[model samples]
Target: MLSSLTPIVCGIASLGLDHVKLLGNTIEQIAWQKAGIFKHNVPAIT
Candidate 1:
């Protein structure tokens, strides 16, 4: 699971994988969920 990915770069690629699902199924929600890994003041790339 990418739950351990701490670099905090969010993408929409995996959102289509059957094992992963985004309720809103929108790029925005996927990015938002992926950004959950963000650390204080740390820069992230989407």
Candidate 2:
């Protein structure tokens, strides 16, 4: 998941690299995966 909670646990900004393998070689694919973290009515940063 691409939750802000991830960075909170790691103490570092998320660069979306961890899903590199899972996302294959497409920016669209990565974005689709990251979008899963967006919660309805909750604000997201970057």
User: What lDDT would each prediction earn against the true structure?
Assistant: 0.53, 0.59
RMSD of each: 7.2, 7.6
Model 2 residue 28 CA deviation (Å) reads 0.4
Query: Candidate 2, clashing residue pairs?
Result: none
Instruction: Give the residue spans of candidate 2 off by over 4 A.
Output: 1-18
Task: State the local distance difference test value for candidate 1.
Answer: 0.53
Off by over 4 Å in 1: 1-24, 43-46
What TM-score fits each model?
0.40, 0.52
Please name the candidate that would achieve the greatest TM-score relative to the true structure. Answer: 2
Give lDDT tens digits, candidate 2, residues 1-46: 6665643321123546566788645766777766776666556677
Question: lDDT (0-100) at residue 13 of candidate 1?
Answer: 43
